[model samples]
Target: MRHVVKEKSLEDEEEESLNRQRLTSARREALSLYRDILRATRFFMWPDSRGVLWRDVLRENARREFEEARFEKDPEAVTRLLIGGRDAVESALEKLAEKQRHQIQKERGDGR
Candidate 1:
């Protein structure tokens, strides 16, 4: 038996598709930022597993900014989201440097 979808359900599905498309478009601007965030998080996961605080903060800020842009319907907020996401990713990268420092110190101690 072939199942038929209700008209209302089809309409809802279309609306959901549109919403997803819009979200994808907005996120395209921040894709690089997201990748950077991931790289930073991975970098910070070494040695003593430190820098969790800043990494979490950057992640939260990036999430908040993206949500604001996705739902605010304001052009300015959308722009801010793109910029803020990039900045947050950079902040995460800076934290990664601290992780690198900790790793270096640990290696030096072991050598000594």
Candidate 2:
């Protein structure tokens, strides 16, 4: 009886740890995706000054994408979409960061 109890306790601990890891990863991914979306929108609308107009359109499209992906009900597909979206967003942000860095360097050169 004591051995069985110990085994169950260990199993419970392992499950808890796995759940915690999953939650932490999900939170990190969510933040990354959110940041990417914001950065991408800014990059798109900045020079042309269409931020306000584009925001509404982007929001609608984003909602539809989420709903469609969720409705698919396939774990693999869900994971792929979430990861793909995050990667795409991260890529956009990286591009924006590089552009900003270049612009800063140009300004410094002109100031010299």
Candidate 3:
């Protein structure tokens, strides 16, 4: 009985340790994604004075979304959030690039 109890305790400790490691990794990835999204906001362009407003909106949106997910305890949920955020950021970047390309083409008198 004693040996079985000891083995169970060790197993529990190992499981707890693994969960802590996973949580730590998830937090690190979340923070990295948050920073990347904020940094990418700088590339957003808007005509006239609305540029500043749009940038602020983007920043606030990103912060709010991350805050909403701050209490997520499940590793799978955290991973999903990180992946979704990354995809959204990538899509925004692609749109920005496309817009810039169109502007350049327009300036060159090339209609497409």
- Which pairs of residues have clashing backbones in candidate 3? none
Structure candidate 1, residue pairs in collision: none
What TM-score does structure 1 among the candidates reach? 0.45
Whole-model lDDT, model 2: 0.66
Q: Which predicted model would earn the best TM-score?
A: 3
Better of 1 and 3 by TM-score: 3
Better of 2 and 3 by TM-score: 3
Model 1 ranges off by over 4 Å:
1-27, 46-65, 102-106, 109-112
TM-score for each model? 0.45, 0.52, 0.85
Candidate 2: C-alpha RMSD to true structure equals: 7.8
Q: Is candidate 1 or candidate 3 better by lDDT?
A: 3
Total clashes in model 3, counting residue pairs 3 or more apart in sequence or in different chains: 0
Residues 1-100 of candidate 1 have per-residue lDDT tens digits of 9999766788899988887777677667667666676566654433334645655655666667555555566556766767876776677667667777
Write one digit per residue (lDDT tens) for candidate 3, span 22-111: 999999988999889888988764533654666678888898998999999988888899999999999999988998899999999994
